[model samples]
Target: MTQERVAMIRERLQQALPVQHLDVEDESHLHVGHAGAKDGGGHFRVLVVSDAFDGLAPLKRHRLVYDAMGDAMRRDTIHALSIRALTPAEYERETA
Candidate 1:
């Protein structure tokens, strides 16, 4: 289920954004009995790099990602999303 959710999320984000680098990590197990986990939704952390976010404000970037996740967020497949939206240059600098 964790792998499936990650795949689904990766696909959705890729389809919605021109991602240069994307990583999705399932953190549900780390949550254990947290209220959201008990409700059956998954927790995920996403690091996405895309030119699509080039000029967007941080909140707008998050909104774009949330919009991309559309059904996953709305349907409870994703309980919480920790996202780091970055442009390719930003990613390169961070890694450097």
Candidate 2:
């Protein structure tokens, strides 16, 4: 179940963005007793690097990710999502 969500998220992001790098992690175990977990929703963190986010504000970047996530967010398959959406240049600077 955990891995399935990760795969689904990664695939969805990849399809929506021209990602240079992507990492999706399941953090559900850390929030095992959290309220959302009871609803079968999972907590996740995603690092998305793409030129698509260039020049966009952080809020907009997140919006794009949420939009890409689509029904997953609305349907409660993803209860919480921590996103680090960045352009390729931002990624380079962060790694540097």
Candidate 3:
């Protein structure tokens, strides 16, 4: 189920943006027994590198990521998301 959710998230983001690199990690186990976890939603962290975020501010970039997550969020499939949205250049600089 976790793998399926991750694949769905990746597919959604890829469809919405020109994704250069993407990683989605499930962290639900770390949050077990937490209040939000009671609802069956999972915690996830995502690192998304795309040219689509080139000139966007942090909030805007996050919004893009959230928008890409559309239904998953609305339906409670994703309870919490830690997002790292960056342009390809930014990714390279940060990783260097």
**Per-residue lDDT of candidate 2, residues 19-88 (tens digit):** 9999998998999889998898999999999999988999999999999999999776999999999999
lDDT string for model 3 (13-44, tens) is 99999999999999999999998889989999
**Model 1 Cα shift for residue 35 (angstroms):** 0.8
Q: Which stretches of candidate 3 lie over 4 Å from their true place?
A: none
Q: Which stretch of 10 consecutive residues in model 3 shows the poorest summed lDDT?
A: 68-77
Off by over 4 Å in 1: none
Cα shift from native, residue 54, model 1 (Å): 0.6
Model 1 vs truth, CA RMSD: 0.7
Per-residue lDDT, model 3, residue 36, is: 88
- Give the clashing residue pairs of candidate 2, or none: none
**lDDT for position 70 in model 1:** 92
Residue 28 of model 1, lDDT score? 90
lDDT of each: 0.94, 0.93, 0.95
Higher-TM-score candidate of 1 and 3: 3
If ranked by TM-score, best first, what sequence of candidates would result?
3, 1, 2
Model 2: lDDT of residue 14: 93
